[model samples]
Target chain A: MIRIEDVSLRHGQTQILHDIWLTIPKGGITALVGPNGAGKSSLLSLIARLQPLQAGRISVDSFPVDTTPSRDLARILAILRQDSIVTSRLRVRELVGFGRFPHGRGRLTPDDYAIIDQSLQQFDLTDLSDRFIETLSGGQRQRALVAMAFAQGTDYLLLDEPLNNLDMFFARELMRSLRRIADENGKTIVIVLHDINQASAHADRIVAMKSGRIVADGTPSDLLTPKTLQAVFGFQMRVETFDDMPVVLHFR
Target chain B: MSIAATKQASKTGWVAGLTLAVLFVFSLCVGVDDMPIIRLFSDGRALELLLVSRLPRTLAAILTGAGLAIAGLIMQTLARNRYVEPSTAGTAQSAELGILLVTLLLPSASLLFKSLAASAAALLGTSLFLMTAHRLPPTQPFLVPLFGLVYGGVIGAAVTFVAWQADLLQYLSVWTNGDFSGVLRGRYELLWLGALMVVVAWMVADRLTIMALGRDASIGLGLDHARMLQLGLIIVSVISALSVVVVGMIPFVGLVVPNIVSRLMGDNMRGTLPTVAVSGAILVLGCDILGRLIRYPYEIPVGTVMGCVGGLIFLWLLFRRPSHV
Candidate 1:
């Protein structure tokens, strides 16, 4: 379990997240949904220790996040942010090979290569493994990045809006892939998602936030109601159930 | 591709290694004094100059070239942009300023003292660059290097002004030339420290690589982003500052060698550092040899030859539409 207690953050004088408390249970897909400036990314950063904590405690699997050795932390958790820009011309396989860095320290043994190859196949990037990352399109590049994270072999995977800039088909495919990884591999996945329906369809649990505070947290079926949507997004939306999942119609 | 083609592609390093070795031997032979090859070892004065002076200078050039190239690779990786290097990004100028200040203040300061001052100054400049980067809105990351160039140019102009007024322009020119002539046995020992830094850099290469991805990603992976970056900057400053101290400012050696090596051998630091070292050695040695050949007895400085040739090569590398991905 990932537990956050009284986490507060201030950028200069402006408060970003205030006295936030959250708990993400193990072995499932949890989607964090919020509007812009809602501190979803900030909270993720704090949990992952990407940014230093100003005033809170975070623990991953009972170990305090702040005190754990980075290599130890890397073993348990892997994070993929929205923007991963690598300027060097690295082939897709080489990029995925970096997933083994925390474990092998850049000298990959046979086991590391096996894990890398498996990750490439899992992400359906086996065909493009030899291609350079710069040559790949947006969706392909995102897959390559996801493949790398998967290759990390961490139990807890944190993705900050992994679907940004992906087209409709690729977005659904990626969501499906994440769902499979979480279900089949039994990995605990925490993803920040913009599309409410994607969260509703794929997420086992949905945590809604606004103004840096978690207003609601429950199963997607329980949390994706029109009332909660109105409260969280400040918008009136119609909701319908398809395949036993709540789909919010906010487009019109 | 055919079997021969595949084998050829895989042997890029070997080809580069052979070329560098050949060039090194040629560089050893070519110099201001055209003593016969057999007499080089027998003649006492010639032997002393060649073995002690020329040999050290050549080794200094090789080490400086390697250190600078790796430093550039680190900086470019950290910044996540091409077209950025320590010299172009102002780190070298800041180091030079530090050296100039210490020299002016304490004329009797040892070379080590000057190097420390230069390292400190380079560190300060790099910190300023990073802090300033945080406040600005996101755009092309290349803006960092552009700003660095402008910043470096301002400091470089100031250095020139100071040198002119102090009637130390000749002294300043010597530092700017990237020459290997003055490097002797005792004076050039400082370069061994840079080789140690390269080793340290390799040990921390994993951390540096992750940090290069993005601040958030590195943090998510639980790496101390700030400390890693600070460490990288420290490495870069020490290498650039010491390179300047040893053989003036040999401009594009840093930019050209790493880019070439990264393109050829993958970007992994473990795989590429050796190639970068060899390629840097070859480039500098070739330039040094060319400098000797062009002017003969006059002995043009290695810096001028490198700048002229390296500038043209850099332009070609930048504009050649980049064949390799």
Candidate 2:
């Protein structure tokens, strides 16, 4: 379970998050959806301990984020931010192998190799394992990065816009993979998504944020109505049922 | 994508092997006298010169190259940018200025004092850069180097102004050119400290690699981000300053060598490190040999040759598609 308590973030009189309190459960997918300037990324960063917390406390699986050792936190939670760019000349296998760094350091034991290969296969990147990351297409590269995050073997995965740069096919495939991981492995996945329909389809719970506070949080069916969507996105959204799931038609 | 090409390519290993062999042979053969390479071991004075002078100079070049490359690798990793290196931080120039100031202040200062002063100055310059630019985005890697270049130029101009006033420009110019000709048993011993740094860097390779992912990534992975960055920066500054002290500023030995090696060997800090060290040694030694061959009796300084070569290569690199990025 991830718990955030009275978290208030301010950067020199500009408050980014205000008294934000949220409790994210241990399993299944939780999509953090919000409009622009909603502080979704900042809140996620604080949860991942990417930035120091200014005026609140957060804990992951009973370990306090501020006091926990970095290695310990890394083993517990893995985060893939949208703007993470590595300019080093690295092969896909090597980048994925870095996911296992906290466990084996640099020496890849047989077990580490197994995990790396599993991650590569899971992301459908086994063929491109030896290829340099720079040579891969954007969709392929995004998959590789997601695969690396998976290879970290953490129980909780905090992904900030993991679907960026992915094509429709790849996006659905990625969401499916996350769903399978969540269901089969019982891993806790928290993803920040821009596309409301994608979140509605895959997310077990949808949390909507506006003006640095979560305005709504409930099951996808309960919280994804046009009324809530209107409040969250500032526009009316058409909702329909498809195969017993909510399909939001917000394009118009 | 190019693993097949990498497997088929013998260029890297071949270059390393050929350069090492050529440097060894030339260092043994070429000197002040007309003593043939075959007769050196038998002749007493020739043997003395070979063991006492040429061998140490060769080792110093190799060690300095290795040290500088390691320093560059650390800096690039810490900054999370391919273009960053120790020399880009005005470290080498600061080190030179520190030595010059120490010499002027105390004419009878010990070699240790001069080196320590240079190292402290380099550390100070690096800290100043960090303090100023720490808040800026790391994507603009060139800003630090540009700042460093301007800082170095200012120091250089200041040194020149002082030297001109004191009428010691000739002495200063000689030191600045960075010739390894004076390296011998006692004089070159200080460089072994840089070799020690190479070992230390290798030991911390995993931590450095984690640190390369950025402060947040490293912290998320349960490492002390600030302390790790501090440790890496310290290693970078110390090695760079020490290398400058051992052999004057060998331009681009840090930037070009590590970059080339990383492309061939991939960015795993462990694999790329040894290659960078060897490649740096080969490059410096090869350039030094070229210097020896061109002016046989009157040696052109190694720094001048390196500067000319590095300038051309840097221009070429700019035009070419960056392999690292």
Candidate 3:
């Protein structure tokens, strides 16, 4: 479990995340959904230790995020930020191979190579593995980045807006892959998602945030109601049922 | 295809190694003294010149070239901007400042003492540049080199002012002009420190490449990003300072060689380091030879030749479409 208690972040005079208390259990997909500037990414960054915690405690499994060594945290958790810019010219396979650095320290063993190959295959990048990352399309590069995070073989994965720039098909495919990984591998996935329907159809639980506080937290069935959507996004939304799942229709 | 790629890279490495070897022989042969190939064995004076003067000069040229190239590669990787090198980033200027200070304080200081002082100053200057770079917004990549140039100009002005006041301006110019004409066995042994740094760089090549992936990605991969960056900066400083103190600042060997090698072999540091080093040596050797031949006995400084060549190449690189991922 990842436990975040009384977590608050302040940048100068503005509060980014205010007293965020949330517990994310192990071995399932939990989606964080919110409107623009809702502090969803900030909260995720705090949990991943990408940003330092100013006023609270966060722990993954049993290790404290603040004091734990980064290598130990890396083994337990891997995070992929949204605006990751790879400045070097690297092949797709080479980028994925870097995910194993925590284990191999840049010298990949045969076992590490197997894991890398598995990650490439998992992300459907086996064919493009040899290609340079700069040559890939935006969505393909995004997949490659995710594959790199996956190749770290961590038990917990924290992704901040991984669906950005992805087309509908690739987006759904990525979500499905996340769902499968969660179910089969028992990896805990905490993803910040922009699309409510994606959370509705895939995420086991949805946490809604607005103006730096958690407004709602429950299963998709309980949290995807029109009333809740309005409270979170400050706009009217229509929630309809499809295949026994609530599909939110916010667009006019 | 992967096998073929590796084979092709090795082939390129071999070709580069061969070129360096040929240049080494030519560099040993082309000098003021007529030391023919056979006379190296028969004549004592010829052998003495070859060992004490010619050989050291050639080694100094090669080591300075290769060391600065490696230093430039590390700097570019750490800065995540191709335009930042020792010359542009104020490393050379800071080193020259260190030499100036030492000459003022300890007028008769040994070469080792001078090198130590210069390396310390280089480290300080590089660290300041890195700290400033960290504060700047990442929106503009070009701003990095510009900041470096302005920063270097300030340091250069300071050194010049001090040297001019002390009436050591002529001495300072000789130091900064980067000619190996004065290199002899004892005077050039300090360059071996640079060679050791090159070995250290190779040992940590993987970490340096990881650094090029940016701070978040590297930290995400469990790398001690801050520590690795510090190590890289130190390596760059030591090599840059040593090169400046020994042969003066060989302009653009670091910037051009690494960029060219990256264009051909990609940025996997493990696979590209040897090629980068060899190419650096080759470029300096070729330029040094040209410098020797251009005026025969009088000889232009290698720094002047490289500045012209490196400036043109840098302009071409600036106008070309960026290939960074």
Which candidate wins on DockQ?
A: 3
Q: Summing lDDT over every window of 10 consecutive residues in candidate 3 chain A, give the lowest-scoring window.
A: A44-53
lDDT of 1: 0.81
Error of 2 at A37 (Å): 1.6
Residues A1-252, model 2: lDDT tens digits: 999999999888788999998999899999999898899999999988888889989999999988887778889999988887766667898888888877866678889888999999999999998887888998898898888889999999999898999999999999999999999999999999998889989999999999989999999999889999999989987999888788899888
Ranking by TM-score: 3, 2, 1
What local lDDT score does residue B25 receive in model 2, on the 0 to 100 scale? Answer: 73
Model number with the top TM-score: 3
After superposing candidate 3, which stretches have Cα over 4 Å from the reference? B322-325
DockQ of 1: 0.50
CA RMSD of each candidate after superposition: 2.8, 2.3, 1.4
Q: Chain A TM-score of each model, in the order shown?
A: 0.98, 0.98, 0.99
Q: What DockQ, between 0 and 1, does each candidate earn?
A: 0.50, 0.55, 0.67
Across A1-252, the per-residue lDDT of candidate 3 in tens digits comes to 999989999999999988989999899999999988999888888887777789999999989998999888888999999899876777888889889988878788999989999999998999998887888999999999999999999999999899998999999999999999999999999999998899999999999999999999999999998888899999897999988999989889
Question: Can you tell me which runs of candidate 2 are displaced by over 4 Å?
Answer: B1-18, B131-144, B165-168, B322-325
Summarize candidate 1's per-residue lDDT along B114-196 as a digit string, tens digits: 99998999888867766765554556555776787887898889888988887888888766668887778887889888888
List per-prediction Cα lDDT, in the order shown: 0.81, 0.81, 0.89
Q: Estimate each model's TM-score.
A: 0.92, 0.94, 0.98
